[model samples]
Target: MAALWPLWGLSPGGSFWQRFAFWADALDPLLLLAPADEIRRSRLLLQNSGKTLSEPIQDDQMRKAFLLSLSSVHPDTDKIIPVLFRPPAFLPICLPLVIVSSLHLQAKATFFSQFVFHSYTTGFALINGNSTTKAEEYSVQEKQIFYSLGAISYAACIGAFPLVFMNRYTMKSPLMELIVRKLLPAPLLGLMSAFTVAVVRSPEFEHGIEVVDRNGKVVGVSQKAGEKAVRETALSRGVLFGTTFFLPNVLTYFVQRAKLAKTPRNLAVVRMLFTTLVLGGMLPASLSMFPQRGEIKRADLETEILSSTEEPVLFYNRGI
Candidate 1:
C-alpha cells in the first residue's frame, strides 16, 4: 500500500486525481462484508510486517489487508467506524437516499426523504472527522443529537423551499418550470449537504483537533488545522452531492427527450441505475479531492504549534 501511493500520485500534497485513484481502490464495496476475524488478521499482518518505507509489502495478503484496514479503521481512534458511515458503504446507502431526495414527490414524502438523507450524511460527517483525543472534554451523545436535529431542520426547510415556490407560483413558460424543477435541486442539495457537514463537525473547529509531526509525534492541538479540515471536507461533499444530483437529472432529461425509455416504469428504473452509477463514481472522486493525511506548513499553524515543533511540515488526519 505504501508503494502504491507513489504509483497513484498520493504524495503528502498529492493532486486531486491521485487522491481519487487511492479512494477508488480503497472504497470497494465488497470490502464492507469482510469477516471480523479476517479484518483482525489483516491489521495484525500490517502491524507485524514492520515495513515503514515506501517499498511494497511482498505478500499479496498483506497488501489487501492494508487497504481494508485503511478504509475501515480510524487512524486517531484505531476503531472501526460504524459500517453505515464507512466509505465503503457510502455509495450503497447514499445513492438511494439521494435519488429519492431528487425525485419530485409529494411534499410530505419530499420532506421525509430530505430529512433522512441529511441525518445520515450528518452522522457520517461527524464520525469521519478528526475526533478529539480527549474524550472527557465534550458530550458526544448530546452533541450528536443536537447537530443531527439542526442539520435535518435546515435540510427540510431549505429542501422544501423549491417545492413550495413551485406550488405557489404558476410559471407561464414550460422552460422556466423545467429549470426550477430539474436544475434547482442539484445546487440546493449540494449546498445543504455542505452546510450539514460544517454544522455537524463544528465542534472540531471550535475545540481544535490534534496535530502531529511527520514522524507522528503529537505537537499540540490546533484550531487552524481543524478549520482547514472541515473546509476541505465540506468542499468535497459539495462536489460529491452537487455532481451526483445534477448529472442524473440532466441525463434523464436527455433520455426522455430522445425517447430512450417510453414507459414511466422503465424511465424510473433507468434513473435509479443512473443515480447509482453517478454516486458510485463521484463518491471516490470527491473523497480523493484532498489527502486523508493532510499537511500544514509550520508557519500556517497556531503560534503554540509553531513553538512546539520545528518540522517545516506537519501532518493531521483529514477525516474522510
Candidate 2:
C-alpha cells in the first residue's frame, strides 16, 4: 500500500469503474494496454483483504513485475520515475502554460529573440570564466553591449527582414522558397549566434577561461585553449540554430503544398503548430549534444600553463 501511493494521481475516482474510466481517458491512444494491465493487477491484489494497494507487495517477483509495468518508469532508471516527471517538477502540467492573447504574440517573440543571445552570452562568460579568472572575465555592461549589437544585427537581417519580405514569396518553385526562406536564414542565424558569442567573448580568447585540476584548484589559463572552447561553443550554437530552425521550416514548405493544406487558413495554422513542435523538441536536444565540460591535454596548453602543473589532464567549460 505504501509503495503504490504515488500512482493515485494517475487515477481520477474512488471505485473500479471510475478507475477504469480514468485509465481509459489518460491512456488514450494507449500503447499495448500496459496501463490497463497494471491497474487490473493492482485492483486484484487490493481485493477483499481490505488492504490498500499502497501496501508493499510481499511477493518479490510480483513487485518487480508491477513496477516494470508502470507507464512513468524509464527503462534505464531501474524502473523508477525520473525526478523531472515527479509532482514537484511541474512540467507535464506546465506544457499548456502559454500566452493565449494573440495581441502580445509579436512582442513576446521579439523579446525572446533578443533575450536569448544576451542570456547565452552572459552565461557563457560567467560559467566559462570563473570568478577568479580576470583574463576570461567581461564586465556585465560589455557583455550587454556586444549582445545588443550581435542580436540586433541577427534579428534584423536573419529574423525580421525575411518575415517582412518573404511573407508572400514570389518564387515560383516551392523548392526555391524552401531554399530562400528556410535553409538560407537558418544557417545564417546560426552563424550569427556563434558570431555573437565570439564577439561578446573575444577577450576570453585573448586571455583565457579558467583551467582546473582534479583538486578543483586553478592551474593556469591558455589563450589557444580558450579559442578552442569558444569556437566549439559557437559552432554548437550555430549548428543548433541551423538544424532546429531550418530543417522544420524546409519540411513545412514542402508539406504545405500537399493536399492537407489546400486552403490558406489551414496551411497557416498547420505551419504554426508544426513549427512550434519542431522548435520545442529540437532546440533542447541539439543544445545538449555538446560536451559541457571539455577536456584538454597537457601538450595543447601554452608553456606557462603547461609548466605551472605536472597534471596531464585539464578541463574547461564549453559554454552553451
Candidate 3:
C-alpha cells in the first residue's frame, strides 16, 4: 500500500504516473470524498493479486488494475436519497447566488449561455438627495445591463469571431477545439465581468465614496479610499471565479473517468448540480472572510475630516 502523506505537502515521486496520482489525490477535497480508505484498499487489492504497485508505480498497464480495485469503493454512502431528488430545480438562479454568496463583485458572473459567455457595463450616477450637492452614486446595475446588452447584441462579434479565427480553414488539435468551444467561454466571461465591474465603478474614484467617522457620521469623501475599495472588490471577484474557472471541465473529466453518467445530458446535468451545491457551500465562507463594512485608519484618509481629538477609525461600504 502507498504510505501516508508527509506532514508538509504531497510528495513528488520519481515519475509522471506518480505525479498524476498525486494530483488526482489532490482533487478529492474538491470532490467532497474522503479517499484515503478507498485508495489503500485499491493498493492492497493490487498487491494481493500479485500485481506490483511499487513506490514508483509507473506502468500504464497498472492503470486498469488500480481502477478495477478502486471500483469496489462506493462514492455515495446515503441510500435514502437519489442525486436529482436531493435538490429542487430552478427556484434559485446562479447569477444571484454568485452575487450574494460572493466574497463581492468578483464571483458574480455576467453569463449569456450554458457556456456562460458575454457581458457589458454601464455608468450610473448615484446622488445623495439629502446632500446639497449630490454625489452621483455609480450605477453598477446599469453597467451590468449594458454588459448584458453588449453580450446579446454582438454575440457573434466576440464569441464567433475568435472561434472563426481559431478554425479558419485550418486544422487544429482536439485539445484546441475543446479550449475554443468549451473551456474558453467561462473564463472569458469571468475576465470580462471583472473588467466591467472595475471600469463601471471608476466613478467612485472621481466622486469619492462616502467615508463615515468613528461615530458613523458621513464626513468628507475620499477618492483614494474609494479606489482602494473598488480595487479589492474587483480582485475578490476574480478570486471568486478563479477556483471555479476549471470546475465544469474537471467535473466532466472525473465523471467520464468513473463513467458516472448514463448519457451526455445526464453527465451535464450532474455536473451542473454538483457545481451549484459546491459553489453554494463555498460562497458563504468566502464572503464571510471580509466584513461588508470595511474599516480604515482615520489617518489614511486623504481628506482631513476627522477633528484633532477624534478617534482613528473610519468606515465604507464594500459593495457586493
Candidate 4:
C-alpha cells in the first residue's frame, strides 16, 4: 500500500491504466465480491450428508440472500455509493494540493507562477482597488502599513470561502471517513489562513467596536462586552476550522494504526508541529505590520510608509 501511494501521486504522461494503476489496486478488492454461491454449495453438500437435504437447501438460499443484501445488489443504492464515488472522486483533489503546497517552499516562483496560471489565474490580483494618490510620494513606513492591512483582509476572506461551500457538500458525501480523508487540507488551509491573517493583522489585545454618541461621546467597548453575541455567530466556525485542520489527520493516523497494529505511529506530534509552525510564522508577522483605518488615510500624507507594507501576506505561508 505504501509503495502504491507514491505512484498514485504521480501525474506523469502515461497510458490510462498506468496513470490509474494505484487507484485500481486500491479499489480492486471492493469491486470484486466473494463467491457466495460456491461457499453455499459446499456447505449444503456437507450438511445433507449429516443432517437433512431440505434444511441445507433452505439454509443455502438464505445465506445467498444475506450476501446479496450486504453487497447491495438489491433495489436501494445505499451500499454501492461508498465504493463508486467517495474515494475515487475525492482523493484526486487532495493529493494534488498537498503536492503543490509542499513544493512551494523549494521552487517558490515557479510553483506560484504555475498555480496562478493553471489554478488561481481568475483569482490573482496584482494591485487591487483604486488608490487615487500616486505611489511615489509616500514614505516607506506608510506604504508598509497599507499593504499589511490589505493582505490580512484578503487572506481572511479567502479562508472563509471554503466553509461557505463545504457545509452542504459534506452532507452529500456517501461516507464520513471518505469526506474527512479527501475534502480536507485546501479549505482548512483557507480558514486557517483567514484566522491567522485576521488575528495577526488585527492589533493584539485590542478587539472592540468603536461607538460615538449623538453628543460626541466616544466609547470603545472591548470584545468581552459583546462576547456572547460574537461567540454565537463564530463558535461553530472556529471549531470547524480547528477540527478540519487537525482532526482528520488525527483520525487517519489512528485508523492506520488500528490496521497496521505493529507499526510505529508518532506522526501526530509532527503534524501538530508543522501546523503550529505555519500558523505562527506567517500569520503573526503579516498582521503585526498591517495598517489601521487611520494609517490608510495617512498614506496620502506619506507614500514611502505605504509602499513598505505593500508586499504580499501570502508570501509567508502559501496555504500549506
Ranking by TM-score: 1, 2, 3, 4
The predicted structure with the larger lDDT, 1 or 4, is 1
Error of 2 at 301 (Å): 0.6
Q: Given candidate 1, what's the lDDT at residue 201?
A: 80
lDDT of 3 at 201: 61
What lDDT is obtained when candidate 3 is compared to the true structure? 0.43
Model 4 stretches with alpha carbons more than 4 Å out:
1-143, 168-320
- Kindly list the per-residue Cα lDDT of model 3 for residues 159-219, writing each as its tens digit: 3444655657564688776776557655654564455446556656655666664444466
lDDT (Cα, tens digit) per residue for candidate 1, span 68-149: 8877776667677778888888888888889888787866788899999988888888788877644454585578569879
Q: Worst lDDT window (10 residues) for model 1?
A: 1-10
Q: What's the residue-level lDDT of 115 in candidate 2?
A: 47
Report lDDT (Cα) of residue 107, candidate 3.
14
Highest-scoring model, lDDT: 1
- Higher-ranked by lDDT: 3 or 4: 3
Error of 3 at 187 (Å): 3.1
Candidate 4 C-alpha lDDT tens digits along 21-83: 323332223423435454344334433333221122235444333233222221111223232
Candidate 1's C-alpha runs over 4 A off are: 1-15, 53-59, 133-135, 169-176
Candidate 2 residues 1-320, lDDT tens each? 22332332222334545434333332322323345456456444533223332343456544434333333332112243333332212212222221111111243453455344434433443333322245323464466466556654564355444444545554437776555544565666666667766766666676576776644456776677678777877776667555655665666668776676788777667655655565455444443454444568988998888889998977665543
TM-score of 2: 0.54
Distance (Å) between predicted and true CA of 55, model 2? 35
